[model samples]
Target: MSATVAAILVLAVGTYAFRLVGPVLHGRVELPARLQELLAAGAVVLLVALLATGALTEGGAFAGWARPVGVLVGGVLAWRRAPFLVVVLGAAATTAGLRAVGVA
Candidate 1:
């Protein structure tokens, strides 16, 4: 099949599988502790992977300063346990201010 057709089939199958999982798992069986830990770690791993990849890209292979600046500010904000909205706004403002002044 063509790539587009294959993609549609995969998406449809995956969506149906997940939608089925909810009803199939409706208090039928409790998640094992090990499985729970693995699931939690999987989420964290995916988040870190995305950040290390190009979630905040400027359309290049790490060719922008906004990402690093935002990461630093966000890291600091998290380290200090600041509010989520404030941390996000601070990161955006830092990236915007830096780019506006031609730092990137």
Candidate 2:
């Protein structure tokens, strides 16, 4: 196999092994309450960081005002419990409409 393929296979196996360990040790290991809380907060922070990065940047540069505005609209709709399709299409439409009017 090529080096790239071999590396991919190794990574796949490692990922599966790590996932398997979680279930195998789930009830056996006990985590402190503080550690669990920290993990939960860390997950939220990581998600927010990812969302901000994706919404505001492209190729390591600013993505422009249109994209972030679109994300804001989508977030508001989602928070209001709008349908999933509506949230996605609304964001897309908002971005496209802004770009169409030369806002970006």
User: Which candidate has the highest lDDT of all?
Assistant: 2
Provide the lDDT at 41 for model 2.
Answer: 100
Predicted candidate 2 versus true structure: per-residue lDDT over 1-104, tens digit per residue: 89999999999999999999999999999999999999999999999999999999999999999999999999999999999999999999999999999998
lDDT of each: 0.85, 0.99
Give the Cα-based TM-score of candidate 1 against the true structure.
0.68
- 57-102: candidate 1 lDDT, tens digit per residue: 6566665876688778977998899999989998888888988898
Candidate 1, after superposition: displacement of residue 34 in Å? 1.7
Candidate 1 lDDT (Cα, 0 to 1): 0.85
Cα deviation at 84, candidate 1, in Å, is 3.0
lDDT of 2: 0.99
